[model samples]
Target: MDSIINSRNRCIFGCSLSRLLSSLDGVIQNELARREPSLYQWYSSNQNPLVVRTFVNTFENDRRFNSATAICSEGKPMDTSESDLSLLVLGLFCLAAITKLGSAKVSCQQFFSMVPDIIGRFMDMLLEFVPISKAYTLTKDIGLQREFLCNFGPRAAVPKFANDHGLEISFWIDLVQKQLLRALDREKIWSRLTTSETIEVLEKDLAIFGFFIALGRSTQVYLSSKSHTDSNDSINSIVRCDRCEF
Candidate 1:
């Protein structure tokens, strides 16, 4: 009976994982269609190249206008406020992922190979619209950015780049700790609550902290690797320069 139950649990877990991956795939596809409608239609319908290129150019122009409007409000309440920053980051990341996944679908390159470059490019573009300091601060306050980095591991592969651009891992971890403590304080206030209520509070708090911890770990790993790579490259460049001079 126990063996049967274990097998059932494994099957259920596998099914859930499959569903999650499928949902992620669907999200990528939908966002790609929205971002590059002409490309989507052309590929889907097997249309002519010249017409498709024109359509694509028009679509790109439209997207630039829309993105600019989203990044900067004209005559309206500026949409680039702190409240919308999280959503903007998520949207930009999603768009970058979609572009990489699209390339992967067409080419033989693995998705992993394209993710870091795509994310880096997206971050660069996004920084132009919103200051990195604001982005980091907002991400630190809420745990969403950490959660995102944890979810997309390869996207977190360039910690030095992020740090160089002003995202401090220590600062983010400290913020997460503060948030966790606040949650604990709230839980303490409800100490007289029922067992289920206590459990719920604890679970929510753990979820938030766990996300930050995972993000911190990933960032640390990426930064260490990046630092090593940069060091080695610099040494090699120096050696080449010395040889040429000699």
Candidate 2:
């Protein structure tokens, strides 16, 4: 009886996810029809080469870049092993979206503006199953989480936004990383860590390195063209360190 109930529940959950994807597809289709009539016509007729490439790129980034990091963050300090399953569902959804609707034919400015909304929706759906506390733990990695929050958090007109959100996010990430590093060092768990465990740690560290690279790139693109020359030089210096080679 318990097994039957569990199977039924799983079926219901799958149906619900299917419906949600359909709804999102409809929304995107309607939005595109209203916003880009020419592109919508091209997509409807199945005649555009760039449409397929753009769709693939968007889906790939959503899956590889955003979804992977989100999954990793979902797995931190909580019983979130099951949350990893969301990546599969999200990938399927992206595949379906690309197959049906293709990418939005919009300006970069419009696309950038739309991205946060899309990300927020994705995060909301993920949080529905995973819970915020667990996700927060995963996202609070010292290097990436702080930079992410600084870029995205809400702004209050009275007080500065970066100070408010950035500081809190930074503190949490720092606290978690310090605790982890201290535990690892004190326990001398490196000796005990299996090859897989060591690899996981190395991957997390690489994620941090990737976050720094992204930050430098964003700074170079938006701030000063020369900004990344110094940043790359700094990264090269650090990467040359004996301990950093993993």
Top of the candidates by lDDT: 1
lDDT at position 145, candidate 1: 57
Q: TM-scores for all candidates? A: 0.29, 0.27
lDDT by residue for model 2 over 79-128, one digit each (tens)? Answer: 23343334534533443343334244332333334433443343444444
lDDT of 1 by residue, 168-246 (tens): 4333434444554565456543343334357877776556545545654554455455553324433333322222222
lDDT of each: 0.45, 0.44
Q: What is the lDDT of residue 17 in candidate 2?
A: 52
Residue-pair clash count for candidate 1: 0
TM-score of 1: 0.29
Every model: Cα RMSD to truth? 20.5, 17.7
Best by TM-score: 1
lDDT of 1: 0.45
Q: Backbone collision count in every prediction?
A: 0, 1
Clashing pairs in 1: none
